[model samples]
Target: MVEQLSLLAGEREVDDTAADIADPCEESGTSVSPMLPPAPLNGLSPSLERKRLQAYLALLVGDVAILLAAFYTVSILYFGTLSNWAMLEGGMISAYVILPLYLTVALYNGTYSRRSLTEWQTSAFRAATALVIAAALVNLLAFFAKSNAEFSRMVFALGLASTAVLMTAMRIAVSRALIRKWGPTSLNKMVLLAGGPKLNLPHALHVNASEHGLEPALDDPRALDRLSKYLRNMDEVIVSCRSEDRAAWAQVLKGSGIHGEVTHQLPHEIGAIGVVHYDAAGVSALKVSSGQLGIRARVAKRLFDATVSGLVLLIAAPLMLAVALLIKLEDGGPVFFVQKRVGRGNRFFAILKFRSMRESDDNGAQSTSLEDDRVTRIGRFIRRTSIDELPQLINVLKGDMSLVGPRPHALGSKAGSKLFWEVDRNYWQRHGLRPGITGLAQVRGHRGATDTETQLSNRLLADLEYMQRWSLWQDIAILAATLRVITHERAF
Candidate 1:
């Protein structure tokens, strides 16, 4: 008989403690809290959350309604007059046959990840895939029931297209509003590691933390003997200086009995049960490879940014002009305010904004908050509505920004500054494409002051998601969602 014992790894405890000490007070001279309770998703802000729920409900109800409507329309065209009872009967049977298939495929591919819905092309492709799958299932059922001739293939096709369009648009609208309301923030799973300094472990870990949502706390090889107490908190462990510390590594793993998946930089090969070799930041190491976004995804993502930004700038020109004038009349200053922002590849570009602050309030490269004294009355209003960002349409047009990508940051942003990349190697991975005027993060309600590293990591994850699966229609859908977010004053 095997007895199950639960022990927290001591190595993880050291890592957590080190993370506390390693944090530098970057914003407002206060130490941001690292221990964040799980975010409350139950009563997420009612505006988008409620709307999203309603939209889902509406999809199911509207799906049934549309099926009925289509049947009636077809019945009238094919057989002249039809009774209400006949329409209801036809609609019920069709809906029962089709809706289950639709729901299964819709849920399977995550058609409902709010941020994913904003990319229209992606949504449409998903919609097409779901419909095709549903149709196949429906056809099989039709054959089994021997009622293949009862329903017209054309009606099914038309109904599927209409429902897909309706549901996609509804979801896109709801997701956009939610993101803007929430502002590109999420709670992420982070593992902190403690290892020796000889392997330059801290620097490599910091890089992974900034880009891949992995943060390293502190490294003390001596602490390994007490690993049993902290193993649960850690998803992966990195051992530093494989050459000199071979004995220490074995002692730590053996004493803890915490064997599953392990990673390390070893001087000699020990042939662990499940380990792979790779170079991290020019350092030789055996790291358990966790897949990151790929190169082809990066290229397709750039193409997505270019096309959507071009189309949106063209279509939204007149409204953008009105916003520009509104800013000028309120402040009597330059209509557009340009400032240096860090883009993909550590490149710098002037990000455009509608000048939401007073001209005299230039306080270096500081982020403005709701309580900032520098914001003019009009500035506050525009900022809240996110109209102040309208000038960025030009950035998109000029190829400095995308219609949908990660939101660009000032060169000195506190969350992940330009210096962050210099210190943390993986930070540059975010610059795989042009920045976006509105992105997966921005719509999810992450804006203004980001006082925590966890928040920054969350935003980075959303950006990477967009990169991994990008499309032009997705950009257009994001732009539309952006408009809704701005109008509703979700961001401040």
Candidate 2:
């Protein structure tokens, strides 16, 4: 497993065959037109998805019911009689708290996932873990809230233990029953072949790579959309391509929202993140990208963005209001500027900024110079002070952007004589992350005008580097470093 594939794989390959394989983790450094976001492809098979949803819903109901029954039963038994309503209600408060907590934890831990339908042991284990965590949290809350005295310790222990045992047993039984009803492998997938060996993937769609538009060109959107159409209703894609083409297919599959695997023969040559052996098929395949960010990382990043943006907005509200008034007073134009910028996944999003340039036909056709005539008196100060970017905090809050990542450019923005994308094909790959208000490029003094290709290329490299090494700590560090440059000479 190459855990550091994203960072280390960018170095030059030792041979020509290896040269064809561009590291999916790094920029390919080639030029092509920007790729379009693929149309929605999944959920094409309503039956499988509908069944999964129904199964999840049923599990949710079953969990709530079991929790209610176990707690009430334990309460009645502890009281020695059902008629003593007041005493029986002792466990109800803790039970109410425990229910929501358990459900929340279970949802995140894959307790209600499609895997739970076939893997009884895993379902039971996750359910038990969620239950234990929920109980611990309730105990902590009770301690902090000074409500521990209201509930009996013995009942809490008995109720939690009994519930855990019941949930585990119930999951095991339900999972087995579901497996019996659904097939052993309830997944939909597509299989591609290599010349030497034949694969016996009976339940999967056998696809021709060329026919389905699987090209080595990330620059082509039509090909990607066609490939996405073929992958619709599929959970996984296992392809047998030459080692050189693996990286390209990996990127395509990653963008398609499908789990991708490339069958490997020369393991030593490929820098795979991990290798999955299909013992039944007698072949090993490389695991493709786990995604630009995992679900947990995404959730954490989102929470961080919301918290920081919300607080910053609160502190800067008065200042924003003052800027708005000044912009309006200056030219009676709109205080805020909204422009459609290419965002994550190559989707268009309206980025908010305080108007810095004069109201003209400017559509990012040119870079803002240090002393452009288009700048109004208030605009120049705000631009130079980086105050013009404050409104993007709203973009972060609205989930259209991030606090740290690649800074999105205008569609018409260029590097020297060419457009940004034309300057480097890797330009589109930077959109793998949400555009940021402050990024590695900005912190490294790569801001302001991009009068030459080298400037955009350098910034692009930093953007790619940031994505490769992305983490909460790094984001915090980049954000802290950003404070040093808010008034830098390059802010223009």
Candidate 3:
């Protein structure tokens, strides 16, 4: 049956018509082979399993110790001594109540999972979030227990802050120690691949698998016993076969008692943003999103843009006025340059900037060089300092741009002789969000003239990455980084 399934899978790869493949079970008089044997019960002995349990226990103990230390330190600092009557009472209550609650929350959030342990950043974020939630819950518990009087608000705040810092430090220290002892490559969980020999896996799959500590083993479908032995240590099984053989592989993996997934080779350029499964009429279908933010996120982003941009413009009004006067005095041209630039939804809007160039009829597509004769003396200083971009705050306030997004491109903009859209098919996708005064690409030193295809591609990738991973915190971080980016040698 395994051989028959493999043959049909191979034929399905070549033949486009699904009706051409025949089921071996239907053709024969015999019933389909019974499900593959269950996986071995004793893959690891009792002693080895005990050691794994001990490691987890040790981690829990270390966390408790760290929390205790944080509470004591905060109590001592705030009350001048741990012996303070109030401090001692608060410490005891926290030890008996808050710490256990925090630990429970962390566990529920999967902060201590093997995957989380290996990826310290993800674990740290989860820990922080859990701690925050736990703090809120603990406060409510104190109120309900009528024990709020026993704790000092100052001490509670200090403890929470110190605990977050100390816990993060502990996680980092332990992760580093683990990496050193196991060697980074040794820490990855194992994965098993099942499919015919002809399956073509992409090079990136192997690279990413190794990086994520997924040690992959390719198994022969005929050797069920050997495959079951391999499954004992595997964290997951990925079936990489044609659709026709999916059922057989599913059965084999199901009885193996391991989590499984099905996938096929994908083009290098296509990235998986997210996956959604839904029913279309009576048929089920899977959809892959290509980095589009939902409506709620869009609304939140606009609100954030409006609030931040308004505050910035209010504070910088005087500076903007001074710059406008200088620009007009330098060349007596328009105080602001209003040029049509492509924005979100592939629409055009007039992008505002303090006029920094001499009056000219030059086409906007013409690339500006550092030594361009059109730049006024004042223009050099403002452009170098990035003050010329300040007027775009108006555009943000007008809902024509965002404070942090892909920078809008001028119409007819080209990388060398080719238009930007012609340089890459995905170029226009950058317009999925409103263009910004500053963006991920700009902060990464991709701010200069994109005169080559490679430069444009690099900027496009950065834009796509930012869009795919957008968060309010990320935007604020990028805005802060913009200060440093403006002084970069390439900013001019």
Candidate 4:
């Protein structure tokens, strides 16, 4: 009888495995029919390519308009009229010389042809740099032509400043509008994930994949055949397979006639490190190194943290005192709530905040809800405006935190009734740097109580991404983004 039961269980397992690889159209809701062969795999369709070309032309035209407008506006403001044909002629000559140079520098900086448009900070930097370089070139040209004395320095300066501001603003506005209109599909890439067991990707990655038009192709006998028909629609194919199955999958991808790059996924856990080098010997070997910042970088980051936090604390001292008084008068409890939070290297630090909750015996372990009864009227207002968090500037001054890093959580914080660390092994990895009063995750809309595993996972992924891509400029961007984030409905 036991043998018969085991055989039944084995059959069920086989059926389940078969079910996992059934035609993907049924699950994905795609319009492609399973019975018909996929369309021939080829390069992008002519219509699609034409659309991209048109978009590029439109961007170029817009930029030229901005350049001409800046030049004319600056000239009018400086010389009082277009009646100054000499100054106008010089401005025209400068524009003619600088336009091509600006475009060339922008191309070199990946300003016109990069996937970073969605990030306004990167786009703004590239635009401003390109304009500055073009302005410098214009100056050089004037010197070489012995016409430097013929042009007014004020006009040149005003033109350069106006052009930079206008161009940066235009790019940011256009990029944001495109993102809102098309979501991540504006990226213009159709990625296919093929082979292996499905990856349990972080929630943030899943959202990004959806935004970027990533789709999964079931690992079935017909997957390669189905892929060939849809090749024209796909920009890239990413194969995820076990090590033993990698060669077979590669061959399958190569035979699909996709006419584009085929990439394979590495083992996620083992490949999470930044730097890796291959040693070409009898057997292939990889050496991975920790990607920690150098001593100079650490010193610079520390200096920036100290300087910015100190200035902010000084400016905010009066307001903070007023909030402290308000909190004290509300319930006569302690004005500041100092709680032990996990900081860099897993050390504990007392993070300071204006007390926003009624004094209770709960130790602040439970996550606050949107309508929690424990919140005071003053607390609600302060929390919504993020005024309660101003006291954490003290933590920043004390070196317990940075102005921008992963936010620290209280020792007993929970996600869905389970400790956050228990929810994800990688939760503690965010401690690689000092905790922050405002972080990348917070600005990206992951602030407030992490009530579920998905919330915790998304926040953790954002933190990890920030750690991997840390830069001084990125910190400044996060700080700037915090202003917008504070006005979000979820900020409370």
- Which numbered prediction scores highest in lDDT against the true structure? 2
By TM-score: ranked, best first: 2, 3, 4, 1
Tens-digit lDDT track for model 2 on 345-413? 555567888997785433587777776788899988998888999999999999889999899887678
lDDT per model vs. reference: 0.51, 0.72, 0.61, 0.61
Q: Is candidate 1 or candidate 4 better by lDDT?
A: 4
Question: Runs in model 1 with CA error above 4 Å?
Answer: 1-307, 360-365, 415-427, 469-477, 487-490
216-241 per-residue lDDT for model 3 (tens digits): 22121123322333343333344444
TM-score-better candidate, 1 vs 3: 3
C-alpha RMSD for every candidate: 19.2, 10.2, 20.3, 21.4
Residue-by-residue lDDT tens digits, candidate 1, 299-411: 46556656765676778788777877787787688877777665532344678787777753222346566577777777777778776777776777676676677777664
- Model 4, 332-433: lDDT tens per residue? 999887776666644446788888888542345777778888888888888999988888888887888988998988756778877776786556557656
Can you give the lDDT of residue 263 in candidate 1? 38
Enumerate residue pairs that collide in model 4: 38-229, 39-229
lDDT of model 1 at position 158? 62
Number of clashing residue pairs, candidate 1: 31
Cα deviation of 407 in candidate 1 (Å)? 1.2
Candidate 3: stretches off by over 4 Å: 1-291, 360-363
